[model samples]
Target: MRPWLRIKGVFVYLRAFFSFVLGGLAAGCATVGPDYAGPPATPLPAAFTRAGEPPEAPRVAAWWNQLGDPTLASLVERAFAANPSLAAAQARLLHVRDMSRTERANQMPRGGADLFYAHARLPSMSGGAEDGSQLPSRLDLYNVGFDATWEIDLFGGQRRAVEAAGASVQAAEANLADAQVSLAAEVAQLYVDLRGCQRREALNDDAIARQQRGLDLARRRREAGTASDLDLARLQGQLEATRADTGQLAAELDGYRNALAVLLGLPPGTLDDELAKPAPIPLPPTAVAVGDPTALLKNRPDIRAAERTLAARTAQIGQAQAARFPRLTLMGLIGIGGSHLSDLAHLDDFTALAAPRLRWNFLDFGRNAANVDKAEDMRNEAVSHYRAAVLAALRDAEDALARFRQRRVTVATLARAVEAARRAADLTRERERAGTTTMMDLLDAERTRISTEQRLASAETALTGDFVSLQKALGLGWAESPRH
Candidate 1:
C-alpha cells in the first residue's frame, strides 16, 4: 500500500479509537466507590456557659483590633509577614494547588513529539559460505514523529484523583489559616505578658519608694525615742523584699521582649527600645461575639482542615475501587525513516501506528481488593480524625470561656481590694498629719495598697490573656491577618 494510504488508515483507526474513549470520559459511567459526603455533624451546645453577655453581632475577622491595642496589632502584622512557620504553611498550600492542577490536567488528551536516530551493521549468516554468501551490511535509521496517548476514565479513576487533590488543596488552605490563628494568639499572649511584667515592675518600684519613706520616718522617731528599733528593722525588711521583686520583674520583662522579637522573626533586643516603657495591657470587651458551638465548629480552621482531609480520603476510596476495573488507553504514533536524506522525502519511508490498550489486574489474586480495603480503612480513620478535631475545638472554646469568666471575677476582686487599700492609706495619712496615728500605722497602710496594686496588675494581665485564648479557640482574626 502507498505510505499516504497507510498513514490514512492509521489516522482513521486512531480517530475512531480516541473518539470512543474521549466520549466515554466526557460522560463516563458512575465511579466505582461510594460518593463522598462530608463528615457527620457533631452535636453542639446551645450557648457557652461562661459567655457573660451575648455580643451585638458576630465577631469580625479582626478580633485582635477589638482589644484596642495598636502595638499588639502591629506586632501581629509583623509576625504574619515574617514568621517562618506561616511561610512554610503557605508554600504547602501552593504546592497542593499545583498538584490539583496537574491531576485535573490528566482528564485531557496528551501529545508530544519524539526524534530518534539509529545505526546498525548486519552480521554474516552463520551457515553461509565464507565467500560473501551474506555480506556484512551497515544501515543508519532516523525517524521523527508526534505521539499521543489518552487514558479514558471509563471508571472515573482520574476524576477521583483530581477530586482528592482538590480536597487536599482546601485542607492545605485550612492549615495555613490555622497557623495564622495560632500565631496571632501567641503574639498577643506574649505582648500581654510583657505589659504585665512592666506593670509589676512599676508597682514594685512604688512599694519600694513608699517603704523607704516609712523607714525614714521610723529613723526620725527612733532618734526621738518615739519608735522602737524593731519597727525600723521590720520596715527595712519590707523595703528589701519589694526591691527584690522589682529586680525579678525587670528580668521577666526583658525575657518577654526577647520572645516577642523571636516571634516576629527578629533577633533579640530588636524590640527592646520600642517596649522599654510600660504600657497598659489590652482589655477585652464585656460581651464576646462567641457564636454557638455549632457555628463555631464551622468556623474553626482545624476542624475545617480535618473535614477536608476526610473528603480527600473518601475520594481515595473511589480511586482505589476504580483500579479493580479495566483501564482503556488510546495511543497513536507517526514517524519517518530512510537510509539517505533524499530517501526521507519519499512517502514510502513514512510509518504510522495506532493501538487501543486495555489493562487490568484481574489475576492479582486479591491485591486490588486489599488496596480497596486499605483505602476504606484510611477513609474511616479520616472520619475519626475529623470527629476528634471537632471535639477538641469544642473543649478548647469551653475551657477558654470558663477561664475568662472566672478571671473577670478575680480581676474585679483585685480592683476592689486595691481601691479599698488606697482609701485606707489616705485615711491613715490624714490621721498621721492630725497626730492621731503613729508613723508605723501610716506605713503599714501604704504597704497594703502597693501590695494590692501588684495583685491587680497580674490579674488584669491574665484576663487579657484569656481573652486572646478564647478568640484563638473560636478561630477568629486570621481572615484579616496580614498575608505574605
Candidate 2:
C-alpha cells in the first residue's frame, strides 16, 4: 500500500470512530420510556366561597396540632412515629428507591473476576528400566481471568426502566404521605367522638338526678292519696331510662379510647387513663384557609400519589415498546483466576488480553409485543384511576362545605328548643305544687324536657363531627391545622 493512501485511510477511520461515539451519546440521550406529561389542567373555581370563613388555620406537619389538645397532639405524634401501617408505607418507598438504583445500574459498565486452579497426578511410567519405574508425578495448573458486561442502551430500554422506577419511588413517597393524612384524620374523629360521649354521659347524669327528685315527689303525693300508683311507676321508668343512657355513653367512650390506643400503636387499654378525663373537642381557628379546589389537587396526598402512579405506568409503556427494538449490549471479561494463588499476578495468564462482546434478543417477537400491549393497557387503567380520584376528592370537598353550613343552623335551632323545654318543665312543676296541674301533666313535661336535652346534646356532637368531616374533606388533616 502507498504511504499517502495509508494516511488517508487512517484519517477516514478516525472520523468514523468519532462519529460513532457522537451517535452513541445522542442515542443515550433518548429515553425510550413514554415521556411524562404533567396532569391535565381541570377547570376550577376562580375562588372558594368559603375562603373568607373563619376556618381553622392549615398545618403542614402534624395537622392534629390544630386541634389544640395537648394529649391529642401527642397521640398523633406517636402514631406517626410508630404506626405499623405508616411504617410499612415508608419502607415501601425506600424499596422503590433501591429499585430505581438497580435500574440505573444497567446504564453503567459491569465487570467481574474469575480464578481457576487444578492439580493432576501421573502414574509411574510402565516402560522404565527393569524394576526402575518412574515414581508417580504430580502437576499443578493455575489460571486467572476478569470479565465485564455493559448494555449500550441503544434502544433506551434501560433508561425507560430507570424512569419508571423513579416515578414509582415518587408514588411511594406520596403513598406514605397519604397514610399519614388518613391516620391523623381517623385519630381526630375518634377523639372527637370520645369527647362528645363524655359530654352526653354528664348530661345524662344530671337528668338522672332530676328524675330521681321527681320520683321522690311523686312518692310523697301517692302516700298522701294525691298521686296515683301509675304516676309513680311512670316516674320510675323515666329514672331507669336515664341511668341506661349513662351506661350506653360510657360503653361508647371505652370503645373510642381503645381505638385511639390502637391507632397510636399501643396495646389495648393503654389510653384508658389518659383519655378517661373528659375534654371538649378543640376547634380549629376561624381564619384557617380552605384554598380553592385547584389547590386541593396539590394538597391531597392520595390524588398526588395516584397521579404519580399514572406517570410511572406511562413510562413503563415506553420501556415495553423499546423492548421491541434492537438492544446492543457490550460485554467484557477482565478478571484473573488460578488454581494456585501464586500465579494470579502473571500478566501472561489466560485472561490478561482485552475482550469485548455484544448480545441481542432478536427473537421472541410475539412475547415482546404482548408486553408492550399490556403496558399500554396498564397506562390507560392508571389514567382512569387518577381521574376517578380527582372526582371523588371534589365531591368530598363540596359535601363537607354544605354539611358544615347546615350543622351551624341545626345547632342554633336545638339551643332554642332546649331553653323552651326547660321553661315548660319548670312551669308544670310549679302548677303541680299549687294543685293547678295533675301528675300526668308533670310526667309529660318531664319527658319533653329530657327529650329536648338529649336532642341538644346530640346536635352539639353532630356539629363538631361535621367540622371534623369538613376538615377531612378539605384535606386539612395534614395541610392545615389550628394554632397552638
Candidate 3:
C-alpha cells in the first residue's frame, strides 16, 4: 500500500474508534429529553362522608351482587361474556400486546435466508470464432447468496421505541378494564329498572281490584234507590280510569323486561317466559366508606390508562430525540442457498460467502428535527389530557356522593307519604260502609294510595341507581376479589 494511503487508513480507524466510544458514553451517561415523573398532586379528601359520620365500608368485588339477587348476578356475568362490544375491546387489548411484543423484537438481531437461479447466454471470447468480427466478448455467469441484518442500538433509540410500545400495551389493558366496569354498571342499572317495573305492576293490580269492588257497590246502592245517578256516574268514570292506568302500567312493565333482556344480550321478546313475575328490589346498605381520593389514581382503570399514555409519550420523546443523532446499523445475510436443487443441502458453500453491511444517513438533519418537535407536542397534549382526566374523575366521585345522599333522604320521605296515604284509604273504606261517604270517595282514596305506593317504589329504585353510580365513581368494581 502507498505510504500516504496507509496513514489515511490509520487515521480513519482512529476516528471510528473514538466515535464508537463517544456514542457509548452518550447512551450510558445521558438520555435526552425529560424523564417522566408522575402527574402533579392536587388537594384531595381523605375519605367520603355518609350520614354525617365516617362509615365502615366493606370492600366488595362483584358489587352488583350486593343487591342480593342471584338472577341479576347471572345476567351480568352472561352479558360480560356475550356482549360484542366488550369482546371487541378485549381483542383490541390482545392486538396491542402483540404489537408491543413485535416492537420489542425489532430492537434485536433478525435472521433470514435466500436462494437464486440464473441462465444467460453470452458471446465467446475466442478469436478463432467463424470470421470473428470486432465485437466485445460476453460470458455466462451464475451466483447465489444469503444475508441478515441487525441494528445496534447505539443511542438507545430502538430501546425507547420498545418502551413506548410497552406502555401503549398497558394503556390498552386498562381500557379493557374500564369497559368491564362500564358493562357491569349498565347491567346493574337495568336490573334495578326491571325491579321497579314489577313494583309498579303490583300497585296497578291492587288499584284495579279495589276500583272494581267500588263500582259493584255503587251499582247495588243505585238499584236500591239510595245512591244518586250523579254518584253512580262518578264511580263508573273513576273505575274506568283506574282500569286504563292498570293496562298502561302492565305495558310499561313489559317494556322494562324487554330492555333488560336486550342488555343481557338476549334476542328481543325473550324475557316474558323467565322474567314475568314481579320481583322486589333489595335495599342496599346506607353505610358506605369511600377511601382516600388519591387512591382513585391507582384503583380506577381510566386513571391508569391516562398514566400509561403519559409514560408512552415520555418514551416517545426519547425516540424522537435519538433520531437527531446518526443511526448505526449492523447487517449481514446468510442462507443455505444454491442454483442446483441438490446443492440446497450444501452448507459449506453457503458458509463461505456473506456480507456485513452498514448504512448511515448523513444528510436530512431537518427531517429528524421535525420528528422531535412533533413528539414534544404530543407529549404536551398527553400531559394535559392526563391532568384533565384526573380532575374529571374526582368530580364524578364527589357528584355521585352528593346525589346519593340527597336521594336517600327523598326515599325516606316518600316512604312516609305512602304510609299516610294507606291510612286514608282504609278510613275512606270504613266511611263508605257506614253511609257517611259515597263509593266515589272510597275509590279516590284507593287510587291515591296506589299512586303513592308507586311513587315510593320509584324513589326506592332511584336510590338503588344512585348507589350503583357511586360504586362506579369510586372505581371499586374491578377489585381482584368479590367485595361483598
Candidate 4:
C-alpha cells in the first residue's frame, strides 16, 4: 500500500479507538449505585425514666474515679495496661489501618523493578554456531526493567474501595474503645464484689459472735434450771446457721478475688494477699451527672463502631456496583536487554513500552450483578444492626436507671430499719440488766438487730453495684481508661 493510504488507515483506526474510549468514559461516570443516607431519626425521651433531684454530683466521664477509691483507680489503670482483650483490640485496629493503606495505594501509581540473568546452552542435537563446525555453547543474557501501573478512577470504583477501607479502620478503632469500656466495667464490678463480700463476711462473723454469747447464757440458764433444753438447742442451731453463712461468704470472697486477678491479667490467687484484708466498699456519688440520651451517639463506642461498620458496608455497595462497569488501567515499562551484559552499558540499548488496557465485564453471565446484590444486602443488614444497637442501648440505659433508683431506695430504707433495730436492742439490753426483761427477750432483740444490720450491708453493696451498671449503660466510664 502507498504511504498516504497507510497513513489514512492509521488515522481511521485511531478515530475508532478514541470513539470507543470516549463512550466508555461517559458510561463510567454514570456509575450505578445507591448513595448512603443516614438512618431514620429516632425519637428520644426528654429525661430518664427515674430521673431525680440528687445532691450535686461529680461528672461521670471517668465515673470510676468518682467513687473516690485509690486502689480501685490503680486497678483500672493496671487493667488498661495489661488486659488481653484490650491488647487484641489494639492489634486489630493496627491491622485495619494497614489494610486501609493498602486499599488507598491501589488508586495511586504502583511501581517495581527487577534485575535478572539467564544462562542457556544449546541441546546436543542442535547447532549453536553458524559455521556448523562449532559445538553448542552456553550463552549469558542480562535484563533489567522497571514497570509502573496506575488504575484510573474514572468510575470511582477505587475511590469507593478506599472509602470503605477508611471506614473499616474507624470501626476497628471504635472496637478498641468498646473493649476499653468493657474492661473498666469488668474491673470495677469485680472490685465492688470483693469489697461487698468482705463486708458480708464481717457481718457473718459478728452474727456468729453474738449468737455464741446467747448460747453461753442459755447454757448457764439451763444449768441453773432457769431455761429449757429446747431453748438451749435453739441457740445452738442459730449459732451453727450463722457459722455456715460465714463459710459461704468466705467462698464468695475468694471467687471475687480470683476473678479480679484475671481482670488484671495476673495469675489467679496473685491478689490473695492484697485483697485478704477487709475494706469499705466503694460507694457511688450521692448524685449522678447523666447527660441526656443524645450523648449516647458520642459516648457509646459500640454504637459508633456499628455506625462505622454501616458506612463501610455502604461503600462496599458502591465498589461492587462499579465492578459492573468498565475499568481503565495504564501500564508502562522501561527495560535494558542484551545477549551480552555489555549491551546494558549503552543507552541506545534501552527499550520502553506503554499500554492502556480496558477491562469490561460485559459477559460474566451474572457474577457482577450478584456481587452488587450481595453488597446491597450486606448494607441493609448493617443498617438493621445499627438501629438495633441504638434501640438496645437506649433500653439498657432506661432499665439501669430504674434499677439504680429502686436499689438506692432499698438501701436507704434498710439503713433506717437497722438504726431502729439497734436502738430497740439497746433499750432491751438495759431492761434485761435491770431485771425488767427476760433473757430470751434480750437474746431475740439482739438477734433481730444484728440480722437487720447484715441486711443493710447487703443492700448498700447492691446499691453500689447498680450504680456501676447505670454508668456502664451510659457508656460513661470507658474514657477513664488510658486514651480510650
C-alpha RMSD for every candidate: 3.2, 7.2, 6.9, 6.4
Candidate with the larger lDDT of 3 and 4: 4
User: What C-alpha lDDT does candidate 1 achieve relative to the native structure?
Assistant: 0.85
Tens digit of lDDT per residue, candidate 1, span 383-426? 89988998898889889989999999999999999999999999
Per-residue lDDT tens digits for candidate 3, residues 153-201, read: 6677777888889899888878877887888888788778878878887
Ranking by TM-score: 1, 4, 3, 2
Off by over 4 Å in 3: 1-31, 49-60, 127-146, 246-248, 335-362, 434-437, 479-484
Q: Which should have the higher lDDT, number 1 or number 2?
A: 1
Could you tell me every candidate's TM-score relative to the true structure? Answer: 0.92, 0.83, 0.84, 0.89
Better candidate number, 2 or 4, judged by lDDT: 4
For candidate 1, give the lDDT of residue 9: 74
Residues forming the 10-long window of minimal summed lDDT in candidate 3: 349-358
Predicted model with the maximum lDDT = 1
> In candidate 4, what residue range of length 10 has the lowest lDDT sum?
53-62
True-structure RMSD for candidate 3: 6.9
* C-alpha lDDT of residue 282 in model 1: 85
Which residue pairs come into collision in candidate 1? none
> Which has the better TM-score: candidate 3, or candidate 4?
4
